[model samples]
Target: MERELALEFARVTEAAALASARWVGKGDKEGADDAAVTAMRVMFDTVSVDGTVVIGEGEMDEAPMLYIGERVGIGVPPEVDIAVDPLEGTNLVAKGLNGAIAVLAASPRGSLLHAPDMYMDKIAVGAECRGRVHLEAPVKENLRQVAKALDKLISEVTVVILDRPRHQQLIEEVRQAGARIKLITDGDVSPGVAAAYQDSGVDILMGIGGAPEGVITAAALKCLGGDFQARLWPEDDTEIARCHEMGITNVNKIFTMDELAKSDDVIFVATGITDSFLLKGVRYFKRRAVTQTLVMRSTSGTIRHIEAHHDLDKKPLFKDHRIKLLGE
Candidate 1:
């Protein structure tokens, strides 16, 4: 993949975030998601790659666009596989809460795992702790490993987990292990990637999250030189069958960073739709909208933070959608 495509992906997520930010606090998650999906779909056409959606909105029958196997870009060179979450935390955006982002991961064809939409039990840590923790390890044991790798006391380690009933036991185990906890209501991708950045104040991320998100998170971690491990957690026969359809015969197999995002030639980009530990939410100004985005490439091992200001009247991005500005 060319380095120039990194900026193209930034524009894609930025458009999605700007479009969906208008729906914040409206109490309409579906509306916010639609705005994001439509904007992202439109932006992809402006890029110059022959892209296939391996992990996307949904199946062809479920989503109108950006669905699995859907083709994007200008039908050009650098064939790639795309995995996207146009609105990663629709509920967070609808409630005007934090931790919402529009994110995407792109890599060469056959470089990304075709993860089905289901639950995946994940454990992630920074580069320093890579090869130290394992998904099959007990929660306390993993925490202990992270603490030892980071040279922190057990009580100094901070683990982030999704706030859900399913995490009750996981949460308790972490507590018993004597690590601090940060619980989020929605969106685990941010924290999952944040674990790779020591300054992000997130030591590790644990618990189950969407499999599609796990792949996206894996791409970012691979770029950041972080360690991530996960196992598909299918809820029933239906989901298990879905995994098999994707050629995942070993349902209990643990996926490492390399397997999840096969190649180092991967690009991950995300734009914040709401304030969180990793990024700030979009801000509307007089005739301008400000967005903060993170663009990373595993090939170059570079992470770029982009802060773009869009001119409402001049930018072609907003013109195509003709979306009503939030403050206007």
Candidate 2:
């Protein structure tokens, strides 16, 4: 993959965040998602890559999504596998809550795992804990390993998990293991990636999250020189059959970071739609909306935080909406 494409991905996610931020606090989840998807699709055309959507929206429910197998980009190459979550936390955006983001991951063809959209049991940590945490390991044991690796006491290591009923037992074990917990609702991508950054105050991340998001997380961790592990948690026959259709015969097999994002040149980019410890959300100025994005490259092991100022008038359709109060 070309290193140049890394910045191109930032534009793609920035467009999505910029478009969706308009609906913040409107309490319209689907509407916000639609806005984001539309913006992302438009930006993909400008990036020169022959891309295939291995992981996209619409797999969680019947709602419209950037379906799997969808082709994006201008038909150019380094033929790539593309995965996107235009609006990672629709509910968060709809409620004007923090943790909403627009994320995209791209890798050379056959480099990214075509994970079916379903639940995936995941465990992630920074480079310090790499080769220590395992998905099959007991929850407390993983936390212990991370705490030891980070040179923190059992009570000091902080683990982040999605705030859901499904994670009750996992949370309990973490608590019993004496590690702190950060329970989040809706978005896992930020926290998952944040776990790999020591400054992020997130030492570990584990739980069942969307498999598609898992692949995206793996890409980011790969670039950050972190460790991530996951096992497909297919809920039923439908999801299992879907996995088989993708030629995944071992649904229970654990996937390491290298397997999930196989390419040495994977690119991961994400623009925060709402505030979080990892990245700041989009901020609207007079005539432009400023977006903060995180871009990473696995080949070079570089991570960048970009702040872009957009010119609303140049946007395709939201010119009026974005610059309405600017009086242009």
Candidate 3:
């Protein structure tokens, strides 16, 4: 992918974030998500790549826009595969909570995993701990390695996990291991990538999240030279059958970062929808909106934190005005 494409992708996420930010604290999670999806779909039309949605809202039959296998962009050169979460945390936006984002990952054709929408067991850590931790290792063991890699005591290590009932045992194990825990109600993608930044206050990420998000996280971590490992967590025979239909014969196969992202030539972009550790939420003032975005590229190992101020009065998000910038 060309370097200029990263900025183009940033605009896509920014449009999604700006559109969704208007719905924050409105108790309308679906509305916020719809606003973001519509804005992202519209902005993608201006991009230069010929992109296919490898991971997105849903399959074509289930979603009206940005569905899996859907074609995006202007049908130009440098065909790529895309994975997007226009609104990563619908609940966070609805409650005006933190950690919501509009995130996407892109890579050369066939470079990204066509991850199915299902639960995935994941373990992520910063570059310092790369090759030091393993997903199959016990929670305590992995924590120990992270602490050792960072030259900190086990108790000083902080682990991030989604606050879900399914992680009860995993949470307990981390506590027993004497590591601090940061439990979030939704959106693991931010923390998963934050674990790669030294001062993000996140030492590691462990537990289950959406498989598609895991792939997106892998792409970001690849840019940071971090480590991410995952395995599909099929809950029942139906999920297993779905995996078979997707050509995944080994339901329990563990995926390394290389397997998930498949190439170093990947770009990951995110615009914050709500306040979080890595990026700030969209802030609106009058007819303008301010956005903070994180853009990363694996090939050059460059990470850019961008703060943009948009003149909403002059910025028409959609060609058809599908969503009002300030929810007007």
TM-score of each: 0.96, 0.95, 0.96
* Candidate 2, run of 10 with poorest lDDT: 319-328
- Show model 3 residue runs off by greater than 4 Å: 58-65, 318-320, 324-328
- The model with the greatest lDDT is 3
216-326 in candidate 1: lDDT tens per residue? 999999999999999999999998998899999999999999999998799999999998879999998997989999999988898999999999778776765555445
On residues 1-328, what C-alpha lDDT tens digit does candidate 3 reach at each position? 9999999999999999988998899987777888899899889999999999999973321333477898999999899999999998888998999999999999999989888888999999999999999999988899999999999999999999999999999999999999999999999999999999899999999999889899999999999999999999988898899899888899999999999999879999999999986899999798778999999999998999999999876876643477853455
lDDT of 2 at 73: 92
- Sort the candidates on lDDT, descending order: 3, 1, 2
- Quality of model 2 by C-alpha lDDT: 0.87
Give candidate 1 regions above 4 Å deviation: 58-65, 320-328
lDDT of 2 by residue, 114-205 (tens): 89878999988889999998888888888888988998899999988999999999898988888899998888889999988878989988
